[model samples]
Target: MTGTASVADMDQLGADVARPTLRGLGARWRQRRTAAAQLRHLTTYAGRPLVALTTTVHLLAGAAPVVFMIGTGAALQHLDDGGAMPWLALAIGAFLGQQLLAPVQLVLSKAVARRVDAACLTRFTAFALQRAELATLERPEVADRLAQADEAFEQWTLTPGAAVEGGLALVARYTQLVGAVVVLGVVAGPWVALAGAVVALVARAGQTEAFFRWGQLIRGFQPLRRRATYVRELATSTRAAKEIRTLGLVDWLDERYAAENRAVLDPLWRWRRRVYGVPFLTYAAVALAGSVAGLVAMARSAEAGQVGAAAVAVQGLVLCARFGVMFPESDVKLVYGRSAWEALLEFEAQAQHDAGPQAAPTEGRITPAQAITAREVRFGYRPDRPVLDGLDLDLPVGTSTALVGVNGAGKTTLVKLLTGLYRPDGGTVAVDGVDLRDLDAHAWQRAFAITFQDYLRYEMPLRENVAMGAIEHRDDDDGIAAEVRRVGLGDLLDGLPLGLDTPLTRALPGGRDLSGGQWQRLALARSLFAVRHGASVLVLDEPTAQLDARGEAEFYDQFLDLTRGVTSLVISHRFSSVRRADRIVVLDGGRVTESGSHDELVDLGGTYARMFEVQARRFGGTDGSSTGAGDDEMRTVQA
Candidate 1:
């Protein structure tokens, strides 16, 4: 499937997918998460040196401003006390620190931003690749999430940012507060100091709640922003661009783009007004009460004639503590900042699955009743609209089974259930005679290789695009090159500037585009490469849709040869291509209508026969020229 079709499919994938109800806030506070996780992720992908240097620069630069703030505040207080002329020089030092910080922060921020952006892109993709086969990515919900990916303000990456910045600010600001307290205590009693700290926290928390809402509102609008972005990119993309102009579809798409844009963002603006207006009003009321309480305390002291220059110390300390006491606001901001992944954090769901190697059974891994079988399967993407019902299917040892269906007949859904992307609501999908639910999703997913009709054309180096087939072998350069050759793409890449090293995307410099047929060939090569790397079963779901007539014929002719030793389930709509399979199964209204050899189906005059007859009529429709199966050759197969 092209990107456009993929987007459409994903948007429509509403009920069929087995998505868990989103719940819970992160139990482990954001402050408690390892700063090392993001750092380690970046270091591993982009190299330790870059990660270290960038982190060092970022931490130091980010901390410098707060250091300047506290240091300057201390220097000012020292100057105000008329303590020493030498302190004026120290004040200039703090001014110099402030002067030096801004530009340095800009540079480090840029460096860290680039590194984290690239690193997250690489690592999350690698993470997904570890468990995500074609069937997983083929799910519409997964595509929606992937398309929604952005670099603006990832909550995970920000853990390190918050740690470095928040920690430093707290330390530096607290030092300023402590210095002020010492000088004030020498003049005034400790009661003034205590009251100031209390009020400062209340003030900071109030302000932080107001500021944090603005942040959430802004970030929450992004999914819609992405939906708009998806349209713009799809319109310009290589595949969809052709159809967009030819079908005069730019306006239709632009409207959907505008609609989703409005829908996603409309909430942000509405919530922004409420979050900003109410919080500020509430904080203003709170701030008024706090100021009155402080004033009343001072007024009583003044009435008692206990006020003196020491009063100066009490008032100055309050101001100083208020400036420094923005700590709890930072904490509150931190919590609200990750509203989305709050569940992951609160749940402390950190230990990742260790994907043990999937053990392929000795008997071609298909005991008929053994591996990856669906029994009494029932599913629906929507209420009262069951797609697949009572479907009992099993693959015996060492065989190729092809699923033939018209559009929306649940061919893709079957693949998802078998591959463990979606779970059946009513029945079970079993692998190695164990229900998939009983097996680890990660390990179970790791066992199969699948190429969807909508397989990705990665905008990476030519070799890396092929390497995605079985990513464990990504470092195996020889294997990557061999797969490139095996897929008949050697000639295609040979003439490029750097062969397999040449970027497969024309969007970049020194990059190139692949024709539809070539991309299909590359996707096929990827699935085959996985087989070579020990994928027990191969699934090709409408894998020939990108191919032209000739490429389809060539692919069909080589299909059995390509999958000779592997158990295969090929889902296709084209009857001619699937007829040679050991068994051909037809689905109608989401139930298996027929299953047999082509000859048996043709003789039965059932659903398969009706479909075959309908397709056969395409041979000489309107015009007298025949373009379908040859008369005797077709008859022999049908017989």
Candidate 2:
């Protein structure tokens, strides 16, 4: 009725009433297969003995319903004889057995499901974290799929135990139907049981189709759900709480949330209209009429002395059990369970593909000894807009080098490349003339201790916070305390309630949050802690930006002492702060425009000299002596 098939359309449609329905069935089957495989895999984590125990108990529970029906029929038959009290007792016992088993089955099902969930979540989360490239984690598409996969096991009704219960229910119901048919054939005829089974199957198919449609609607709502959640978080989040109130955007966000709700619900309403307006009502009417007709036919046969009261009773019970073979909740679970597995597998494959190839080092790995050199290295987030084009640089062993660049001049990108978070698109970054790609990335990374401009504040104990940088020394309280003292946090330790063991954030009970400057100092301590753990190179990317002028000067002096013989590359835009480096390189438009010590650069009177002069003047140093203006004057006089 939905589509009038012409000859050509019939060819396309084949024999199915709805092509989409057939496709849905196929997809559902595939998903079920995937879910079954995953469930089997989950059993490994759930322990085989527990699974077997639960499964055995569940099978016994499944037979209880059929046993109750058969026992009741026998009791009804013996009631006419007036002496078979044991049959009545058997019937009552079977009924009580079903009731008793329900709670035990429910508890066992939940226990199995929870164990499976824990195991699956752990495996999938580990899979997500194992991507070799950082870029794969940043993709929004990948994030969306990952979120869906993560949500799969959270729904109780969609759990593995529930899915198994659904299958067992089918088997139980069909078993009852068989017993009913044999009983009916002895009393009335086989036609009555046959008619009932046909009607029940048809009715079940209709009900399942409706639920499958509902499942599809739910799937479509996922994006809207994500959007609504994001908007709601913005409305209620601490980070946006002040701005939301100040900007008076409460009503606006409320309207947007409502709009998202409507977007999700409107199409669902239309679908409901189609489902209930005619087709569902017709299905209900036909099923009800057919079932009533069958019962009436059995009653008439009894009146005519062709069937006994037991036959009529058994036929009714069998009809009820047949309808229980499939249910809306079970169908929904089947559909969504499949969806979750599909999303997880798809996301894992995509993440691996997007990570590209990270081959293990083919050549023997060696630590950088002489110098780390970037020779014509190139890269960019976008293919068309290259960030580091033919960039060349060098940092010799045990010498401090400062790299100064304007914003987006590839300083952070270069740091990522050096740390092997990204691979260069052209030429090579080499350590002592060995191509970096040929060296083990992990081995190479151990040579440098880095602190970026944006550092994390781990909401953990102060000791663990600092010790995370060198995890081997995590239990070494003395080493952690020494590093904290070296970073100027020794004074604050005396005031802290738990000293090094104090939690770093108020999120935990009795925890304390640190000031911005305190966190920065802790970050420095972390880097220095790594230094104690055998890291020979230090890379600081504006790590002291949060510190005041006095603090900056004091920390830098301490830094210079700690890294006196360590190969270090300091990235900063504050010209005065980096003047103490053994050599300074100025980058402009993705290339090294100038390179020298402070005096040589001033004598050269190149880009570095101009930058220093402007910065010095801003700081009220008109004489510019601090910026090597004396070098320029002395060179001029010599000429």
- Highest TM-score: which candidate? 2
How far is 557's C-alpha from truth in model 1 (Å)?
2.4
- On residues 1-639, what C-alpha lDDT tens digit does candidate 2 reach at each position? 011222333222222322346676798778557666865665666677776776666566555655555566566666667744776676678778878877876676567666766666666776675553666655655555555666666555564444444443344445545555555555555555565665666677667666655655554455555566678777787668878899999999999989866755665566666654565676667667766766666666643352235444545435643572445435555566655655676777876786566557534224577999999988888899989998899989999999976667788889999878788889789889988777676678777788999989898999888987777789888888888888889988778998888999887887899888999999988988888877888999987778777777787666668779899999876765687889999876777879999889888987777777666765677433233223333233333
lDDT of each: 0.59, 0.69
Error of 1 at 289 (Å): 8.7
lDDT of 1 by residue, 1-639 (tens): 123332233333321121212321232224235432533333354356644564454455434433444444444555546753454455466567656754764454445445544644554555455534443455444443444343324544443233333333344445545555454444444544455555555566555544454544444344455567777778777778778899999899888778766765555555556555655566556655654554555445432233333344544445654652246523433433233223222212221322234334333322233445788899887749888988888775468898976666788988888876666868887866777766666655555778998889898987778778777688877887777777677788678898778898888899988888898888888888788887778899987777777767777877888878677899876676787688988877777878998889878987667657755676644221222443343333334
lDDT at 139, model 1: 47
Per-model RMSD to reference? 8.8, 7.1
Which stretches of model 1 miss by more than 4 angstroms?
Answer: 1-164, 178-182, 189-199, 212-318, 321-336, 340-343, 346-372, 474-490, 620-639
What is the Cα-based lDDT of residue 367 in candidate 2?
Answer: 54
* Stretches of model 2 off by over 4 angstroms after superposition: 1-48, 152-189, 207-213, 245-252, 268-286, 296-332, 357-367, 430-448, 622-639
